[model samples]
Target chain A: MENTTKDYSHIKGWGIDADPKNDPTYPMKRRTNEEHLGYSWERPTLQPQTVEILHSNERPNVTAVFGTSTPPSGLSGMIRRLAFKKTENDYGHWLPLILADRINVVEGIIEDLRSGHVPNIFAEKGYKAEWKYNRGGLLRKAAVAAILSYGVVAYFRAKKKRKHNY
Target chain B: MLAMNYRGPLRVRASQKPMPKIEHPQDAIVRVTRSCICGSDLHLYNGSVPDTRVGMTFGHEFTGIVEEVGSEVTKIKVGDHVLVPFNIACGQCAFCKQELYGNCHESNPQATAVGGIFGYSHTAGGYNGGQAEYARVPYANVGPTIIPEGMDPDDAVLLTDVVPTGYQAAEMGGIQKGDTVVVFGAGPVGIMAAKCSWLFGAGRVIIIDQVDYRLEFARNYAQCEAYNFNEIGDPVLFLKKETDWMGADVCIDAVGAEAAGNAMQTITGRKLLLQAGSATAVHWAINSVKKGGIISIVGVYGPTDNLIPIGNVLNKGLTIRANQASVKRLLPRLIEHVQNGVLNPKGLITHRIPLEEVSDAYRIFSEKLDNCIKPILISPSAGL
Candidate 1:
């Protein structure tokens, strides 16, 4: 595989300390011949990659040990692939990735509902702690949620009443 | 084995747990001698970080004596005194090869960003930390460095996280000679960042925080100007005035999600969980930095979208470099600094509590009681 290293040399002082001599703390950091002692051992055997792994586009190959817990799938997976296409610095990359996470949470809830288990969102979201420690904040949030929900229901009910009068 | 147990937010207790054993070929079991409750741990304790399950241990900065090693572990040996870097990196990964140990691809491959970190919740990989009698260290060959001969264990424990993090915060700033650096937050990392800024030839260093004792500590320890942001009213404007309206050359956000100054940020980010912890310091940093100046963030924010002014970042042409400190990369030079007496890693410790009273340790640190700058937990089994 070809090494596709990104050139960030356009940025001023980029990789300035790539040469150790340029480091401002060079006076204090004397070179000890033993710097490599701990790092010189044989590499460990690679864990086999059995799951669908999503890696940054900049990398040439998958890492030796990749996580297999959650593979890219559904809408969030597609968004993640799109996210990986852009460099990390771009807002385009991060915003979509965050959106993907939010979508994944909703997907998880739907999946839980599909199965026999009824997800206890209150317990799962750590609301018990919120009620215990931050009762005022939790109450304020509940009040706001209640008002908004009531307004929506009232609006639709008034619309139905108006049609009947016509 | 006695370990810190996570009951819930603002809740931790000392509980008996089974002694850790080598789970992988590259693992090592260390009997923890010293472990520090990090500012980041408070994020877990405060319920700021997601996926921080109940019954999980929370600690990342630790030093210990190796008690056991896996079959494949060669560099580290049993009975060796060592300090473990918070990052868990397989030595051969592409990122690790480039000395970007914090972003090691293999360690936390489930996440799109950041590698595995011990006891940093499931978001950082579910590796139990060293706030116990024993800890299981994976990729042991790459992460654990033997503490140098005669190095104080207190200093050695800090080297695992705080020293390297603060040093890296300045390094990432790419500070030039005589540049003015303004650090936000006067916590250990912020104080260390201010102190290390001088090593990078910073002409002036100013640290900002709301806490009186911490500001005083920063003023004395870092030998830099320090101010209470609450007293200053507008931190960005004060920084601008201090720099003669030119703003600072570099601004660092050592305070992550739970910043307190901004009411709106506190309400939305901390109180409501609208966005990852408050980006208040980040907002201040971006606004106070000179156009084209650098902003280095070593603060631990949740892995989510933050409300920040990207328009200013682009218009000001500010350079932002942020990450979990690549501890392995910075360890050697930091160890040298400690040896030369240039950086006093142990002097940061103001509170030392036994591992059994881990709950009180968290409460004191969390509430900022006793003018605590740093706190270390002494394991009962240490030196046994």
Candidate 2:
């Protein structure tokens, strides 16, 4: 219960808040989120694009991280939004909404897959490959960053060790 | 009432000195019941005000009670609670009739934005400012607002400058129905512009800033989406992705050259490209807006070559409307919204202080303390 419930409630997708910063678990609730109705700020919503992610935790099983026009829905989607907010030290003004939007997209993909809504549901060979490619890309980036960090650390460590010897 | 006393760059110890008054039949005496510092007011403190003089009242953001009427004044009654929009226009003037109060021909027709501004130098009219107990307002019947019964002065006070400036940013930007709008800067005016965009039916309103504290406060309070311009290397690229590869339907230049850094010299010391820096804003506007979209400016500027790509806005078929908001025209509607609770305009006031503490208010607000968006000033203990 590390408060995994995301608070990315500011995101708007598919005609609703669709995200969790508005989720009740967090305090400092933004009272005006709903009050504004945001009539004047509305823009044509983006057509949800579908993508899949094979996020791994401790297991090697597929999480069915389907992508949709909007992000995934529910608390999990809120978590992703919060992750983006985390990037901006104190969370961005639109982080919640953006996070929520990403969540809605994921949720739509998942829902379509579950309901046989996506035409090439299982046979779409590209889905699995895309997921794997995304995972691989992320792994490669992380590995490069880790190697760079270690290289710098090792360089400093070796220099300090040699300085003592000298 | 006395002459329009101002806080000139030259420090005057005459805090007790009387202001000058006008006896023209067209003039009316207004006891300023409410007044607040404007971003332009800092021009004086910052030594940017041109041809400075003494006894000038520096505030342009004000609401007041009509204390006395001139012989020719007929529309406004004494004791009327009115929010004075900054631009002075004679209603009968050709431009005023067309609602172009900034270019009103009857009064100081040469006055920029239709006529003279209170406390501004000879560039506009040398009319006194509103930062005192009393000010003589010209064409009082035309500009003074009658606060409806039971309306809160704080809610309507901004009708003069900040509120309209904010609304004008949204309006003149030509916000399309369900168009995505983004505003750069989250200052009081920026936040109001974001809020007003929503009020104008924007599908999504985004605000960009590097101040984390301000982003947090605005997102939490104003319900706006915030972007970190500092973290985002290419704001335009990121914004395009955020809006499906279409830039903002409208972009507002709330942060003029000063905020953008010294790379962009300030046209004058006035904040962001209000009317003065329209050209500076024009450059960013052309880039931030989608082709055929509009970019509006509300920040103040002084005369200079804007260095804007004039052909771009025209080539893109982008509409550009830059003007100092005619407070007399926009305040009443803003007031009605406040009175009817259609919107909570008061929420914009992030801090409140007593009249004597106004100096502190100026310090904090100017320094942008604690996510200070807008601070309202009340008298010695007017129960603010």
Candidate 3:
């Protein structure tokens, strides 16, 4: 005689399977689990996944990848080449004032000192603010800044004069 | 590759369709040999069941030869003659394990209204049915049973659905010895239910229907007293008078949606689609059965709510047991009955049309043309 009694161990009441291992397509079926069967509206048990910070969050507390051996190219490369001097350990790239206007070079240097990043110019030789110090690099930088600021003011002044005359 | 295409309500045409291929590791493609147009398919034909998508094929009761098996399909092999159950059950599911194969979870992606039924509609799991030359049977190992050698294929196809449904109707009634049973709708299921009721010790069996031929067939086939509801007065009151105003011990509703009789019910349930198929048969069953008697419903209804007389049910203390037949659970005993010559499952088939003429078969069955009781579609390509 055949056994008519059903084995209820694999049965999940209210229309769901307790063990779906036997059916290979169970995972792909739309109504395979208890949640799809309307048995329980409870959310799925949370899986333990590594939580990595997203691009929208605050930047991590590490030196920026600007002045490394393989420098990033394009507009960022041009900006990095001009703005911050290269450091011994490439640690001065996160100097918070890296985004400050180039005309505020003196203020940027002072802010770097407060932020505990010694400017490469000073670290290379000695702490000096005079024009002749560090191969006259400071004087050269000041001359370039003055020329750019005056050239911008004169062009705008010429455009204003033409608008009034017309 | 010719298959029945659902155009709309009362509109269907046979068109060439692409041969179905195995879609899952558990699926097996079966070359359909004998497919029957089920009475429930009428519900789909009349646009009663929601999501009866057009371009869908529509025959559920089918027997075939397995053409190919997937990598994971182990039980059924290629070229094996088999009868596929209407319910697509993943055998390992909780419901399948408990022998409640009709409520299988993984087969039907739709709402839990019903498990997978081939070609019924999306409401019963949008699996395309077996009306075509080839059909993909998912969870192949679980549902398809090899047709025993020497057993006729015609009988095997009906076993897939109609016979089990009818037998389950009788079983659900919980008929005690010598209990009087009244069955509504003299359709195939009703006749089988009446016939099977006798096996369960029913002393008197009465089947009611408006059609003269079906009523006559019921009397001759089931050996039960049959009545035309139109020839008599209200069937409910007639049943009451015959039972000494006490009512029958059990009532089985074999007619679901699209039932005739109450004008209000017909207008609201059938025309307006307001309630689940006309509850006229259900109303009669509830009122005509003896208080505290059982009412077994093997009829198919829509997934939405129906206007049921719950107050009458509560007052009468009636037990209503209704479900899609769990075919696998009842197969063993039903097969024995067939083998013993006690049951003629294929005796109900009245019309046999080729699969290409499936559209006309649906019309004949739907319109009750030529007194067609059941129509079986024969596939020319089915390696009989």
Candidate topping lDDT: 1
Q: Chain A TM-scores, one per candidate?
A: 0.61, 0.22, 0.25
Model 1 Cα lDDT, one tens digit per residue, B1-384: 899877556667777777776656788899999999999999888877754545567789998899999888999999999999999899675457667778766676435477888888655665678899889888888999999999999999999999999998998888899999999989999999999999999999999999999999998899999999888879899989999999999999999987889888889888877778898999999999999999999988886668989899999999888878888888888999999999998999999888887877887777677688999999898873
Give per-residue CA lDDT, model 2, range B204-290, as digits (tens). Answer: 988887788788866865688997777876677778888787778888877653355223434432343222333334465567788
Model 1 stretches with alpha carbons more than 4 Å out: A1-43, A46-166
Ranking by lDDT: 1, 3, 2
lDDT for B18 (candidate 1): 71
Indicate the docking level reached by candidate 1: incorrect
Q: For each candidate in the order shown, give its overall lDDT on alpha carbons.
A: 0.80, 0.57, 0.73
lDDT of 3 by residue, A1-166 (tens): 0222435646557235434445422211323333324332221112121221011011121111000101123343344433234331232322211222122334434644797866454321212312222336556767999999999999999999999999
Query: At residue A62, what lDDT does model 2 achieve?
Result: 20
Query: Across residues B179-292, which tens digit of lDDT does each residue of candidate 3 receive?
Result: 999999989899999999999999999999888888888898899999988878988899999999999999999999978888999999899877768988888999999999
Q: What is the TM-score of chain B in candidate 2?
A: 0.87
For each candidate, give its TM-score against the true structure: 0.75, 0.63, 0.71
Worst 10 residues of 1 chain B by lDDT: B103-112
Clashes per model (N, Cα, C within 3 A)? 2, 61, 0
User: Interface RMSD (Å), each candidate?
Assistant: 7.6, 31.5, 32.8
